[model samples]
Structures are given as C-alpha cells and as structure tokens.
Target: MSKGPVLLTGSAGFIGFHTARRLLARGETVIGVDNLNSYYDPALKQARLERLQAEPGYIHHTLDLADRPGMTAVFAGHAPRRIVHLGAQAGVRYSLEHPESYVDSNVVGFLTVLEGARAVQAEHLVFASTSSAFGANGALPFSVRQGVAHPMTVYAATKIANEAMAHSYSHLFGFPSTGLRFFTVYGPWGRPDMALFKFTRAILEGRPIDVYGHGEMERDFTYVDDIVDGVIAALDRPAAADPDWDAAMPDPSTSGVAPWRILNLGAGRREQLMRYIAVLEEALGMKAELNLMPVQDGDVARTEADVTETRAALGYAPSTSIEVGVKRFVDWYRDFYGV
Candidate 1:
C-alpha cells in the first residue's frame, strides 16, 4: 500500500519550501498550499513555488488558511494522512502595526487547519510556533515548562492561542499534534523581514543597518535545514498522551488528557547580534554601517532555546554554525540577486 500524501501549508515559504523539497526527495508525495500573500514579496514566493513545481510528486494549491471552505475542500480532496502547518503572519514588529493580520492568519487560520486535521483524521499534525511565546519571562534558555501566559506582542499571543487551540482539538478528538517553537530561523531563501536578510541587504547596499537593543540582543539562530529536520522528526513521531502526567501539577509541555506536546527546535547556541553581524560581514567581505538604536517595543533583549526535550524526543541536534550558515546564505543571496 502506498503512503498518503502530506499536506504542507505555506509551501512557498522559506521553511515550507525546504520541508516540501525534503519530503519529495524522500519519495513522499506532497500537496502544497499557500496564499502567496503580499506580506513580503509575492514574486519571491512565486520563485519558490516554481522550484517545487519541477518535482513530479508535488501538487500546488493557491489558497489561504482563513478560507474555511477552501481548507475543508483540500482536506476532502487530498485525504492527506499527515499535515505540516507552517503558514502564519510571522513578524513580531509587524504584529504591533497590524494586529488584525495576526488574528486572521494565526488565530482563525489555525482553527481552519485544526478543523481540516480533525476532518481528515491525520496521523500527526506538526505546526509551527515561535520562541517569542516566551515573552516577558526573563528566563535563560527558555523551556517549555515555563509559563507562557505573558505574551508581549500580538504575534506571540496568536501563537499561544494556536497551542491552546491545538490542545483542545487533540483532547477532544484524540488526534496527535506537535507544536515546534522555532527560534530565530535563518539561512538560504530566508524571509526579507528577518534581521539576517535585512542586514545583509543593507550592508550590500552600503546603507546603515539598524542595530536594535543597542546591539545587546542574543538569539539561538537555527538554520533552516536543521529546523526542517526537527520538523520532519516530530511529524514522523506522533504525540501520545503522557501516562504519568499529573493533574495537580500539570506539565505545560505535555498533556495527560491529550496526545499533544510542544518542543523547542533551536540550535541551542545563543549568538550575540554583534557577532552575528560580524559573521555576515565576513561572508560579504564588507563592513556594515551600524545605526545603534534602543530596543523596539514588544522586543525581547535575548532569546535562548532549551531543546532538552526536543533532543530526547526526536534526537534533534542542530549542527550548523552561524559562520557557515551565514556564508551559505550570502552565496545564495548573491547568486539569486546577481549582486
């Protein structure tokens, strides 16, 4: 018997595109869905889609997660046994300017995905969360056990909502679901809004790059390939209800009443913003003009991921160093942009 196709949302996205490519390489059929919204550059999304189209095992759908009917139709038509839900309105700063976008895409759109998963009885639903959910905690190496009720931005709040919504669905329907909280994911084919991409563009253009948090910010920058590996591992290993989970002191990462779990997928090595920029400069063979600036609102000074549980659960280990990842990204950027 043949394996059922995997329904991967955000197929044209940075992570989604790579995940789909990996699955196709492993001989798994992938049904890709994306709105290809103008959040950044639809042209870039189109370019990613064009690459996926070259694969024989890939099928594409131009649909938004907020479209309930469209999402339901996809579930009915595809009958996908597994799902990788990575589509969301993803910028922390952008959430402050346009909170409704986060609601439509992250909150409502997530509900649509859950409904589709429930309808299809998917073997496992692995969805993307963010390290920003650890807002205002001030905890070193943020762990899933820490309280996440204090989200600082609308984006984080929406992702927290996704966790809660998935938990409810998993408990009520007995379907397995895993949430991967990604740190600062960076590498080739990255989003233009991310710091790495923005800084690279500015440095190459000989423009001043804004050094936020007075250049004191730190991030566990996981490469896109490492993230995809963790994501696939989580998808292949369906979550199971914790038999020893106690109600009196419930663990936030796993549930006793549901087949639900959350894990941090990060490189586990915090790199300073200044050092990260230095590596990028080395890659480009140019120095950056830095504009030192205070921390932006709704921004944390540091984010470090505690991936102990992720490692134990999926044997996840991020192997890419920032220096190597930055060089790879610089090479891709130069080739893609003819710079």
Candidate 2:
C-alpha cells in the first residue's frame, strides 16, 4: 500500500498554521488545506502559507469546507491516513453577527470532513472544539465529563454539535475520532481576532481596550504549543472505545460503543482577565486604556479546563505559563507587524 498523506485543514489559520509549521519542521510529509477567508486578515494567513511553502515535503490545496464536492475531491486525491479539522468560524461575540457563518463552517464543514474521513477510511480524525461549550456552567476547572448542553453562542453550540456528530459517526462507522476542547489558546502567529492580539494591538496603539464583565473573569488561557502537543499526542494514539464505560453512569465524555472521546487541551489553570492584560502591559511596556463594561451576550464568567484525562491518556502536560506566553506573543506581534 502506498503511504497515505497526513492531511491538515485550516493550514493557514492561526492554530493550523502553527501545527503545520511544527510538523514540517520535523521532516513530516503533510498536505494542508485552507480557504484563506478574510475573517481577519487573509494577508497574515497568506504570509503563514508562504512560510509553509519554504518547508520541504509540504503540499497545498486551496478549498473551502462548505464546498462538499471539492472537499471530497481533496480527500480522494490525497487519501490521507490522518486528518486534522481545525478550520471554523471562531469567535463568541462575532457569532451573533454571523450565525450562519458558524453553521456553514463549523457545522456543515465538519460534516464534510467526517464524510472525507469515512471515504478515505482515515485511521484517526482530530478536530478543534472550544471551552466556550461550558456556557453558564460557572464551574471551576471544567472537565471532559461536564455537561455541555448549555452553549451561549452559535459558535459554542456548533462545537457541541460537532462532538455529538463525531460520536454518532464513530458509533455507526467505527471511526477513531478525537475531539479536543481547547481553552483560551494563545501565542505567536495568533489570530488578530483573538483577545491576546486585539488587546496587545490596542495597548500598543494607545487605544482603549474593552474590559468585559468589569474585569471579573478568569480563563484557562492555554498556550498554542501546549494545545498542539495535546493534538499531536492524540494523533499518535487514536481514540478507542471505553471498555469500562457504563450505561448506568452514561458518561458524556466517552462512548462505550464507539472509538470516540473528548479531551480538554488547556493549561489546567485559570487566571483573571485583568491579570492576563497586565502581563501584556508588562510585555509591551504600554498600558491599555480600559473600557470596563457589563458582560455581553454569549459571554461566560470563567473557563478552567481540567486536563487530568488528557494527561492520563496522551501524556499531555502544559508547561507554558501565561507570563511566558504573553511575552512570546507580544514579541511576535511587534516583529510581525513591524511595530
């Protein structure tokens, strides 16, 4: 049998770009796909893609996930052994303005990926979910076992739907699917739309930064490298059906009949919002003009991921502190933007 390609969708997006760069750095054969939409700045995505092209043994395919037939064609042509589905409409507040964007990209796009996996009979499929799925649970240290039925935004709801969709596919078709619930991932080459990038830019530009919930919030705030480590580890070990799964207990995190599981990829610690902003201030040597406001719709009070299961299953240990991550991010921001 010919060696199957390793496919990575969202190859130009923040997380996907970083993951692709890491894999290529290790002399891995990778086939990357992306639409390169103008959600923030396609120029940034293009720059990342250019960097990837410099790496040897890397192939590129430009396509949108909503293009069902185009997606199928890419899968059939490459026949990847493993798939990373990371492309999606990402943002909590923006989801309100563009609900259909979440539906088309996160929901419909995910279905296309699942279909591709089944068509190629891919051994493993790993995709990105979000901590926002926790919604108003207000629970400290959110675990994989927590109930995620209460999504506050269309984005979170779509991610929750993805987990359920993966479970159904795994159960019915015996797919080895792993869903990673990432919590507040940040670092270099990050999305301009994310909080870190926005806050950093605002602080440096001497503009007012919105401090939602009156600075009364905490987030797991995981670093991007840690998230990638968890994802790569999951790829090494495909999700397997839980033999000890009990129907009486009905665990929401695992499946007894399907080779499917959800893992929380995070730093396993929570920090207050203003504390995170303070780190940015320290790193950038500038202070943010604060616009403290009441909590907006689809906003959560706090998000803390319990990564015990991730550590146990994938040997995942998040070592990047927010202080370190914020510094790294600011350094990259200034260098990339030439500020």
Pick by lDDT: which candidate is best?
1
For all predictions, the C-alpha RMSD in Å is 0.9, 1.3
Which stretches in model 2 have alpha-carbon errors above 4 Å? 1-3
Q: Hey, what RMSD does candidate 2 come out at?
A: 1.3
Q: How many residue pairs collide in each prediction? A: 0, 0
Clashing pairs for model 2 are none
lDDT of 2 at 293: 96
How would you encode candidate 1's per-residue C-alpha lDDT over 40-102 as one tens digit per residue?
998989999999999999999999899999999999999997999999998999998999999
| Error in Å for residue 60 of model 1 | 0.7
- Quote model 1's TM-score: 0.99
